[model samples]
Target chain A: MSRPKRQLMMGNQACVQGALRAGLRFYAGYPITPSTEVTEGCARELPKTGGRFLQMEDEIGAISAVVGASVAGVKAMTATSGPGYSLMVENIGYAYMIEAPCVIVNVQRGGPSTGLPTKTSQSDTMQTRWGPHGDYTAIAVAPSTVADTVTETIRAFNLAERFRTPVTILLDEVIGHMQEMISLPEPGEYQVVDRVKPTCPPEEYEPYGSTDNFVNPMPAYGDGYRWYATGLTHDAMGFPTNRPDEIVVNLDKLRRKIEDFRDEICKVRADWMDDAEFALVSYGSVSRTALLATKLAREAGVKVGCLQLQTVWPFPLAQLRELLQDCTAVIVAELNMGQIVREVERVAPPQARVHSLLRYDGEILTPIQFLEKIEEVRS
Target chain B: MTTTAESVAEQRRSDVHLSYLRPHKKFPNLWCPGCGNGIVMSSLVRAIDKLGLPRDEVALVSGIGCSSRMPVYLDFQALHTTHGRALAFATGVKFARPDLKVIVITGDGDALSIGGNHLIHACRRNIDITTILINNYIYGMTGGQVSPTTPSGAYATTTPFGNTEKHFEPCDLAKGAGATFVARTTVYHTPQMDRVLADAIAHHGFSFVEVLSNCHTYFGRLNRLGSATALLQMFKEKTTSVGKTEESANGKIPIGVLHRDLETTELCDEYQKIVDSLSKGKQG
Candidate 1:
């Protein structure tokens, strides 16, 4: 392959490049702080590629339009911050129920409502998992660097299409706005997954019927295989059903589609854990601090390692359990008040004590602060 | 004693039945016997049939209301979306695939109350989609609540003491919001409803058609508008055609094509121009 072209890119711009590479042809978003650059980049680049970008009236409309475009057989996406993400939760649930393949990028800002629009926080960690009401599984990924933003976004869209559901890319303001120099991936360096289309004739097509892999092939509108799509609980034929047996079967399929493939869906990166007594578990922008803290501690004759979670949901519990087996303790670091730490506490081995290092003052956790917390947690 | 013309009429009726409707789904829709929603649905189907578009090429989208359920019985690519958000979804569909003929079916409350922002923006954008707003003057699906188009002093379940708010004129709202085409007709005016719907569909930009329908089971019973038949009679008597160019002495509202602007560029087409220009700049 020819030499990869190098470019200085913001994290949000990297996300747009990744989406374009993943076949994103439509974007509908309402501008919000710390996340507006993603929309702006899409507005400038998507049209140049013959793709469409729309600034919706509100975040709800943004997500609703994204779902609609996905149903119409276009790879689509939207970006927003905390306040807009709150408005998008309803349609996010709708996309899940209808099994539409789409991606939602939440560059999280602090708050219950419109808090710290310009600052970064990882407060949406839990909300990304259970924001929409009901018993359903979610797939979310976090990127620690501008380059990872591009790769993770491509992975986000791939996972959405693979599972036939909406995927969330959980970003924080730091990663979304921070500038970094990186080389764009050469063509064919990364794999792109498209939604599987039906091979059966129109008369025999069932939009919701399970395939061998449990994911149903999606047929877009205006295709010869026209079908009804709704947020209602539906049967194999894609028609609404209230039958008790059908409801169980339908809901169970939605859960199992992601859970059954957890091995392939979950991802994490472990560094320098070969001979450590303690480790730092981190994700998103906080992982950068954790990495630097580990390096400083290791040089000073302290045995410390870092585990960065790239895929936040499906929790990567088994991987965490295995990685923490030899360690005596694990420090969970994040920008929020002990969100993912709770998950670490739940999944860490019984012999490993779990502690949290949280910083939620609209400031990123620094390496010095993390090193200090490591000493305190170890003591 | 059957003539050739009668035979031809019979054949046309059968052709419409076999061509447009889903036969397997239970006969007679879930609407009430005298509900004007059925009349509106028939008019829509007839309009599409008259346009001669393939069923696969037409996608009908609707929100949560009595009128929104019209898509379920028709054989088209249909999406029954969330309450008050059908226009937003249809906008996405049209933008993604401008080749498809997109149509939205909504009601007064669904379009003017909870979904008011989307409705006005849709008109303002002038996207190439046809919106049919069914104005029954009450929220029939949710059991006779006061709607934005509910006339002042009207008795609704929520407005037990009579509604105190002024009613909305949907056609005026659409026209004010820059809709390329706007029209109004009633269920009682069957031929006029069909013609207006067809014209709205044929219009190359955003088009809004407000159908003044009746909900005798809710709105009429609460306000004592007699029976469904009496409500239909009232519509027939109270609606004056805009083509007449004279005001009705009985204070009837005008019904007919109220606004049309063929010169303004449609939104999707304008976006395509941007795409083309950007591509040219990149290549150059």
Candidate 2:
């Protein structure tokens, strides 16, 4: 039977392959629904690559360990579901505040608390933006297909390394478990990114101070530049302090470093939007439904387009405002109760009405749901 | 092969900070005055110095507490992480780079209360790292809350009327959790503290040190030892040799190297071995 052609894999499995391709050497995570496959996939594959895999006792431990591995100079990652992601917020902030590069894959499930293990939900979209306490910037990507999981996972790591912050590859359980045919090129095809390292002598290195940017090139723990790191609002030297001016400077730098370069980091896919009167805004698995609805709307003699978000954070506000310019109205469809719809409403022109089609029940949004919401909003 | 604590201390004082430590002292160290956290920090720096570990190769992971501030003072790569998860982070750090020396510095409240799960598992897995737990008998940073090591009748901010809970002997707990090397020492005993700290760092597998530190400002005030000198004297009188048999440990808790044995199973070593075997099998 030729071994079934050797290329078909599940989205979770694709994530593991992508992580390996990205040179992820350590994974510490707790198994939760939908996201369990990620840990299982890593457990099955990490042994072949001489990488380390550990089932941490909880989500906090999982992300904390990933941050630690990054500081020690290894590409590291952790995976989790809704509750687990919520538990990981503080440490995620720590990673951003300290400029520790790592990746987190949140295979999102139904929310508030242990809502549903096997089902899918996009409830975490806003949580991903503001989950962690205190203020910082985040780069979050949502993938629609199993293939996109592979590509976005690689990009997630690249963004993390390039910015020296934690990056999230937001996947819904629907995509996480979806089986599809994907051809993964050999390791050389992907451009893997490792964080830039300091070339200065160990004695001359300032762990948090860089001459060119807010981020200092991080030296691996064993590379000889001993630098202090802390979760507290810190000075450039990595020491904890509550000084108001120092906190303002540190916090502003963390937010500005990523926000200033939003044009380079933010990504969105616009389909047939230039002359359309109506637009559908969505991401992750729901974007698939939006595409189907857009096709149906076109057949019904309605000129509609779809904006599929690849990078969900930094909100892609500029692109979104530009996209919504010509549209008479926009329908924002998601699995949650109006999370991204609020952002759409925030960016869309007042004259261009924006409406939401949201679901909190543990079920995928169907094409019919999107069509119904579009018709209701159009009327 | 012979070394004394005094020799180690002198050498450490002159030794340069690890590559991670910057020129000036990191500001706002959370430790209170006359606190023994400084002693523990010095002991660690001394161990790093004596071992001749390249500064950049040593990573110090710490959780929240007074002693958790150790990483900020000494130069070296550090991840001052959340409360109670330092060991878990150190596990990832050590396993990811087995070539580097990974040290976890945690306080009693931080390691034993919220971080309890990580502590036992790290010991059970025998990961190649050293965990230095500073047991000040109370939560120093959060205002003298009763900790896992608070004596049964001792008073604390959280336990104002006096605690009703039983305390854990961290060394015994670590040994029970399968730590390959477990020892107990006090900041007052500088020579023994230095020696035990060095040995713990040198051990191949997971090594745990329960350092009895004095939080004179909080824990001391509650326990009636208001001064640092008084707490040091108390430590001297209370601690006994672990070499004593079970009969001796029956009434008096032995406080030296309570457990030391090597089954020689390290987490990263076993993981790497599995990788090797799998690769070999694939080749065949």
**Best-fitting candidate, measured by TM-score?**
1
DockQ of each: 0.77, 0.72
Note the residue pairs that clash in candidate 1: none
Give the alpha carbon lDDT tens digit for every residue of A166-244 in model 1.
9999999999999999997866899999998888888888777766667898888877776888888888877778899
Model 2 chain A: worst 10 consecutive residues (lDDT sum): A1-10
Poorest 10 consecutive residues by lDDT, candidate 1 chain B = B243-252
Using DockQ as the measure, which candidate wins? 1
The local distance difference test score of each candidate is 0.91, 0.85
Candidate 2 per-residue lDDT over residues A1-379, each given as its tens digit:
2342347888888999899999888898998989889999899888788788988878888998898888888899999998999899878988888889999999998878998888999989988999888888889999999988999999999999988999999999999999999888477777988888989887676666634556678887766666778778887666766889878888888887788889878899998787888899999998888888888988898899999999999799999998888888988888987888888888898789888788878888888887788778778
lDDT of 2 by residue, B249-277 (tens): 55655677767887667888888889899
TM-score on B-chain, cand. 2: 0.90
Kept native contacts, fraction for each prediction: 0.76, 0.88
